[model samples]
Target chain A: DTAVSQTPKYLVTQMGNDKSIKCEQNLGHDTMYWYKQDSKKFLKIMFSYNNKELIINETVPNRFSPKSPDKAHLNLHINSLELGDSAVYFCASSPVTGGANTEAFFGQGTRLTVV
Target chain B: LAKTTQPISMDSYEGQEVNITCSHNNIATNDYITWYQQFPSQGPRFIIQGYKTKVTNEVASLFIPADRKSSTLSLPRVSLSDTAVYYCLVARSNDYKLSFGAGTTVTVRA
Candidate 1:
């Protein structure tokens, strides 16, 4: 079974369009995260949620919002997408423990292209 | 900003040992050194984690110094499929936000 999975593996939209990516984890993890990889292949953390609680929000644009309906799912909605919004988005999850569950497992990633 | 610096790229041949080094001069006491690997169209995958000395697993081995100033990820008998980007991260506590750098791109030659 895949530990983490994201829907819509590929997305292509025009500028000013709206899109959403869905992520789910079956590892029963309490924490989930969203990361973006740019054209240069540089990865950056965008948001994180723990048990449905928003924990970390990087200085992302207002057009991007992360919604976590429960402990197992975190979805990202992008509004007014721009040309620079084109990149690969990743979903990750990790179990919360004293310290044993420190590693984060990532999904296959979604490639978004904005024209 | 992250407290680590690693090479921009590395090259290795098939069936050779590949070691990528990352320097974290200001690693905290409670920080853990972790490594992640990324392919062309995939998210980063956790490779291994270590606090000090040496740590070995099925995929890779992590070598951390006593001072925790630096760490090395050693891949045993790499293949062409191992060509990808590797990231070294300093995970601080459970809730500390993760910071990712440019990462070292490993190119495995045939």
Candidate 2:
């Protein structure tokens, strides 16, 4: 069974449009995160959610929003997608712990292309 | 969280032992050193993790000295399939907020 899985493995849309990517984890992890890898191949954290609460919110644009209805799911929605928003978005999950040592399991990633 | 630094790239011949070193000068006392391997078009996969001294598993070996300021990931008899980007991450805490560094890209020649 896949530990972490994501939907819309490939996405192509026009600028100013809206899109969403879904992620799910069967590992029973309470923490989930979203990361974006740019054309330069630099990966940066966008958001993190634990137990349905927001934890880490980087300096991302306000147009990007992450929603987690439950511990096993975390989804990302982008509004008014811009051309610069084109990149590969990855979803990952890790077990919840008091401190930080848990290793995260990542999904296959969603390639978003904004025209 | 401790930031790690590694070489941008390395080249190795097939069947040779490859060792990639990562330096994390500000590693915290509770931080654990972890290594991950990522092939192009795929997410990273965990390789080995260690607290200190040496830790070996079926895939790779992690070597950390007493100071814990640096660590080395040794891959024995590397093959073409082993060519990928190797990332070194310092587990910030048990909560699992992992921060990834640029990582070292290893290219194995036939």
lDDT of all the models against the reference? 0.89, 0.89
Task: List where candidate 1 sits over 4 angstroms from the true fold.
Answer: A97-100
For candidate 2, give the lDDT of residue A97. 36
Q: Each candidate's DockQ score against the native complex?
A: 0.54, 0.50
What lDDT is obtained when candidate 1 is compared to the true structure? 0.89
List the lowest-lDDT window of 10 residues for candidate 2 chain A.
A95-104
| Cα-based lDDT at residue B2, candidate 1 | 38
Per-residue CA lDDT of candidate 1, range B28-96, in tens?
777788898988888888899888999999999999988889999999999999999999988766653
TM-score of each: 0.96, 0.96
DockQ of 1: 0.54
For B6-66, candidate 2 gives per-residue lDDT tens digits of: 9999999999999999999998888888888988888878788889999999989999999
